[model samples]
Target: MKKLNIVFMGTPEFAVTILDTLYKSTEVNVVACITAPDKPAGRGQKINQSAVKQYTLEHDIPCLQPTNLKDENFIGNLKAINADLFVVVAFRMLPEVVWSMPPKGTINLHGSLLPQYRGAAPINWAVINGEKETGVTTFFIEKEIDTGMVIEREAIAIGENETAGELHDRLMHLGAKLTLQSVLKISSGEFEAIDQSQLTEEELKPAPKIFKPDCAINFDWDVQQIHNFVRGMSPYPTAWFTMHNTKADNNKTFKVFKTTLHSSKANEVPALIELDGKLILALRTGSLEIHEIQMEGKKRLTAQQFMQGYRPEEWEITL
Candidate 1:
């Protein structure tokens, strides 16, 4: 059998793992790597290459950075290489001219199981919605975004209190492994991509891109909601709220990382209490004990440790 010629497109660390794995396989030759252009980052304002681009450079692989995916020049270069297959992970949507070029077409590895959580930020949304399990899916890219036919899927249980960051790591590796499986099967002509609608599942919950307002914690929700929200947003674009001392008239944003749920009946004020050196947020059905937090421009501290130096008697949280 002839060895497969593949071209990969991706931009993040997650995508680099898959490309690295595929590049090592003897059955396929990764002809080229396509990633986003480097831009200035950090306080010093130096050029920062994407994780995929950095890996490509270090490995001496052919790399392309196209400011416009559909530009005639980029398209011309893609035709010149003439790869047989394409793989995408954590990359922008492709135009028909690019994705339809290869005989095997494009295969995408999504962070979440297909036909559900079909959008950006799947890992974050899964934890925020309190899902019991989540997984990765490899699918054939079609015209519609994420509405493609499924190639293969692997499910993993979500830990009772798993943070989004933890789940992200798990799915990242799992996606790499599953993508390898798909590539091998495709090379041998044993793979049959299945339609997502044929699987038959419940309603789909979108994983839309998260914004700053979405990360704001709402004390009016149930304690469990607050708990999930904190865990889901942990370590990135963290769940935050503005806290102020009514007497001092000073306000600062506090990012919540960890919390524990506790039942409560007293109709006390919401998210307003520092009883016994604990930062307590009174939710609708119970109290949320904030275990870990980071004040604006300060280091992360435990609730007990934070209360020891600060007084909540004059503090009031806004949203």
Candidate 2:
């Protein structure tokens, strides 16, 4: 059997796992890696390399960082690698020249099952929408974005209390395994591609990129909806609310990191802070016990720690 020549393209940590797995497999040889250019980050503002770039450098694989996908020089360099296949994960959209360079064609590993949640941030949107199940898909990249033909897929059930961070880790590992399977099967010409349009669109869901406004909490909704929103944005771009104290004449915003819903008979108004010496708020359907929080210009702290030296007589929360 002939070893397949592969070129990998990715940017984030989610893509690094599959690259590591492929490096160990004997059937595929990664000729080069393509990732976004390093950008300034942190307080020092030093250039920070992407996860895929770090992996490629550590493994002594050729790396390419192209600011312009259509640049003649970049395209020329990509063709010089002479790779038979291209594997993409957590990367930006590719032009026809790049995806068409390989004879065996290009395949992408998407976080969600094809035909559902076909966009950026699939894991985040899945939990935010309260989905019961989601999975990973390996597919043949077509002209349209994420509207590709499926090669292989594996579905996993979403836990009732699972957060976006938890789901992201689960799919990251699953995507790696599934991508390896697809590569091996394709290398031996033992796989078939299924058109994504053939799948039923009756229940299709989109996974659009999240923004800062999307992270703002809306307390007017029911408890379940708010809970889903909290979990979906937990650990990153957390759900937040504004607090105003009438007696102290102060206003502050707090971001909620972790919370649990508690049954309460108090009919406190929505977005109202019911302080019992701790940070507890009343939701539309139930009460919320804030586990972790961060006030403006302050580090994250537990509810107990936040209440240690701070006490407000009467405070109202604005959604």
Candidate 3:
């Protein structure tokens, strides 16, 4: 069997996992890697190499960090590889000249099932929308983002209280396995690609990039909605809210990391409450018991720790 020569492109930890799988496969030869350029990061401004780049360096794989994909030199270097196919995971959008250069063309591993939740931040959006199930998709790369023909898909159920970070870990491994399978099928030329338009008729949901403002918790929403929002953003761009301090006459921001819903019909004015030694955020339809939180300018703490010096009676959540 001829091992398929592939050029892997991605930058993040998720991409690194997929790249590792391909690198270890007997049927695949990862000839080269294309990842983001190393840049100074953090308060100290230390140079940081991308996860994929680090892997490639450790394994001695030829790596390219092109500041401009369209540059003649970069294009010439990529063409020199003469790889059979290109494999993309969590990478930036590729130009036509780059993706179309390989003979077998490029295939991308997407976080969500094709034709649904098609965009960046698919994992976060699926959990925020309270999806019961979600999965990964491998498809051929096309002109439009995530609009390519599907080569493979593997579904997984979403836990009711699972955070987006947790779900991301599960999908990362699942995606790696499916990607290997897709590569083998392509290597043997035994699989048929299906058009995205023929997959489903339901309205497609877009997973646009999330910003800080998008992570703000809306107390007016139902308990389930608020709960979903908190978990969906937990551990990154965490869900947050503002509260007015009566004693200090100031507003403080609270970043919520963990929350559990208590559902019931209620017209109570949303506010912070302490009941049975637990900190709860009252809402329109119900309340959420905050398990983990970080106050503005304060370190993250448990509900008990947050309640030590803070009195719920002196604070009211800003609607």
Give the candidates in order of lDDT, highest first. Answer: 3, 1, 2
lDDT by residue for model 1 (231-292), tens: 89987879998988788788999898887775554335666577666788775577877788
Q: Could you tell me the TM-score of candidate 1? A: 0.94
Residue-by-residue lDDT tens digits, candidate 2, 126-151? 88888899899999898998988899
- Residue 244's lDDT within candidate 2 is 85
Question: Where in model 3 is the C-alpha error above 4 Å?
Answer: 263-267
The local distance difference test score of each candidate is: 0.88, 0.86, 0.92
Error of 3 at 243 (Å): 0.7
RMSD of 1: 1.8
Q: Tell me model 1's lDDT, rounded to 2 decimals.
A: 0.88
Q: Least lDDT summed over 10 consecutive residues: which range in candidate 3?
A: 259-268
The lDDT leader among the candidates is 3
Clashes of each: 0, 0, 0
